[model samples]
Target: MKDRPAFGDPSRLTTGAKLFLILSAALLPLALIAIFATLQTSRVADEEARARLRVAADESARSIAIELIGDMVALRVALNALGADAADAPSCARVQGVFAQQAVDGTRFAVLDRSGRVLCGANFALPVALPSDQPIAAAVVPGKGLILAISGKRNGPTARAFFPQPFLATLGTPTSRSSGFSSAIVVRDQELVLDTIDNAGPLDRMETTSADIGIGDLALRASVRSAPVTSSLIVAMLLPLLMWAAAAGIGWFVVDRLLIRPLRQLRASVAAYTPGELIDPGQVRALPAQEIRELGDTFRAISRTVALHEAGLAEGLVRQTKLTREVHHRVKNNLQVISSLINFHARAAPSADAIAAYASIQRRVDALAVVHRNHFAEMEENRGLNLRAVIGELSSNIRATAPEGASSVSIALDVDPFLVTQDVAVAVAFLVTESMELAMSCDPSAQIRVAIKPSEIEKRAVLRVVSRAFVESEELRMLISSRYGRVMEGLSRQLRSPLHHDPLVGAYEIAVAVLGRD
Candidate 1:
């Protein structure tokens, strides 16, 4: 067992989703509140402004009607007193002064001399053109203080007003300009008394149509023309925003504190990982949220499992080292015994052919032994087999044992400087020797061609031993495809592969896969 390492606490975990929800919860209500507040405030302001305008309209209508009636009555009296006599001079003066007073009060008054001709102060009147109308020379007078107006109270491009009432009325009956008494609304110009509080923004925009006032016509019998201030609209729009914001805020709190923060901590641990280094989730806090707390526990469990796995892996590696050294020692001893046996046989042999065959056997055995020797020489940490040196030794030995004068039968190796497993290298060496001996026997003049291509794809070195001289031999083909092939096939099957052989135009090839390119 390896010594355990300490790990940090797992409290800080923030996921994007949780953070988003938090922010949304915090701001959603605020935004909604702002929107609703703004909308309702605007509505209240509009209603208030309209209401003010309506009040102004009502005041102006009353004042205008009073002035009109007073002016008209005085004018009629003045006309009646003009009997070409000086008897009514003071009366005429008083009446004229009253007319002047009415004029000074901003009432646009005119006395028509039966032909609708102006006969009073500010005498320029052909009464200003009415909206959709001509001044009613045709209209009959109703009773005294009877004010008439358009049925609708719409404001057009001109002043909107009209009144038809008894102008004389014996000159003594006091008349009022109140709705249903003396005054009414008209749409001809919309406002009978256009009282702007010292001229403001365009009066036209402020002007409301009869439809805007919830009225069918331009008539305003008793009410003001403009809208009234409404506090109700403000309250209506605010309620929804409050509910939404509260919900949003709660949601945010749940997501961030409960979910996001803990996940972020886990992510940090994952991000800071290195290969083979087990993370110990030591003393991790119970996350604020259930899911995050569970996740932390899960991560801790994984870490514990990882630590155990790492310890087992380390022990296995140590055992592998010891096993490798022992294997090398045994292989080297066996190879030495074989080499000694071959040397003894060669020295005592009566025939050169027997000596060569024994030498061939000895050389292959030595090749296997040399590979094992390399393994035994190294420590437990040293792993893998060197194929180049092994192959070269095999080739060199074969050169030494072949018939002394057979210079034409040359041997060459095309092997990469790679490492392979010991079993694979030993198999490869014997296969090469067998293949070369078979080729030499066929031609006695053939040059052996061998290639050791390390495959990056299969993660193995493939040894393809080819001989151009003995490429088309039926016996060699049978041995390769049947007998020797079976031995190689078993090795290949152990490595989870299949041995492959090919007869080219000028070469008989044996291909075997060995582990490792380098």
Candidate 2:
């Protein structure tokens, strides 16, 4: 997908999916590596198995060969006796029987004469019986010690042949069986070599082998299943899987916790900041580590830059307000001299327009005086002005700004008991009182409502003034609108504040957001 908005997309991952992704990305490759390494280890185990089998087969082959060759050599002594050949026939038979008894296990000593005839002792059963014309029997040869190759295949039909002294335990004894191989021996060259067979196979399966020591049991040989050719492959596969599962689990838990988890937390923290809700150690509680502390310090620096700009604006307002206060004071003094001059000239003017103009000059001067009077009068020890006191004085001063004997210009103060800066209090009271005075001049019967209330919705103080005075007249409306913006802005600067205007309710609101106050 090229892109899809996060809010509505079905494919977008939930928290669980995201965490699984984190785990897989960190763990899966490690699992692969572990599996490969384990397989390598398993190959070593397999090699050892083959080596153990080789050693066992070699030991059994050599042991069987020695037993058979020693038995065949004894047969030579019995044949060499001259008296043993004549009237020693019964003694010869007894001697042969005694020697046959000495045949250890599968080693059945048969004394075959020069004609391959079973003369005095037992014949070992060949797996396949040989014809009378055959030179070598299943495990016997014509000459000296030689091997009767036992095929890896199961032996064919077998028959039991008894010795003069039979092996009592027969085929079931420990000496009868060998590890991973089978054994049998038979007499060969009348009195010469015997032969032993480890494994005999069809011509193709019998790996052609040469004998080193020319004993009666000529050669030792055993066939081992080739590596990777048996069912051991399944073990090879399972060994790696088991080792990988165990190792990958250990790696994921240890490495992810030690390395990946902290890095992810840091990534989330970095992404969470908005324009206003940036890093606040007061909020996140210092991240709790030396490394995160350094990161947080960098975040704090960015936060402080915005704080500093806000502080600079506040400081600028303080300076602008101080300068404005000086200008207001000088204006007040200049207006006072003008008011005195107006009073002097009112009697001198003959026309009614001239007298009304002089009275208007005096009223404007009194309005300016109301601002000065509010700022200078009874400032609090905190160097801040009280909104209540300023409102009270402005109401009282309105009586002064009124036409002669018009005490009917009643004022209603709905202000909450909220405090403000001295310069802000003075400026707001001046503008509001002047607007009320002008409304009064336009309509003598006008009922003015000046209200100061804490706005629940806006979470600030609001100033609302409404007058029906000359509301239809373009001149009075324009004057009201123009001064409304200027008054609120000037008051905000004077108080080092931000103002919100609500034209719908005819309200001007100021947020007394003084830092360090809270």
Best candidate per lDDT, number? 1
Candidate 1: where is the Cα deviation over 4 Å?
1-258, 271-275, 280-294, 341-361, 374-387, 399-424, 435-508, 514-518
Q: Which pairs clash (backbone N, Cα, C closer than 3 Å) in model 2? A: 145-215, 145-216, 150-199, 150-200, 151-199, 151-200, 151-201
TM-score for all predictions?
Answer: 0.53, 0.37
230-272: candidate 2 lDDT, tens digit per residue: 3465555556555655555666665556445645666676677
lDDT string for model 1 (21-86, tens) is: 566667776767777677777667668755654564455444444555454456545554432332
Clash count per candidate: 22, 7
Q: What TM-score does structure 2 among the candidates reach?
A: 0.37
Highest-TM-score candidate = 1
Clashes of 2: 7
For each candidate, the alpha-carbon lDDT, in order, equals 0.54, 0.51
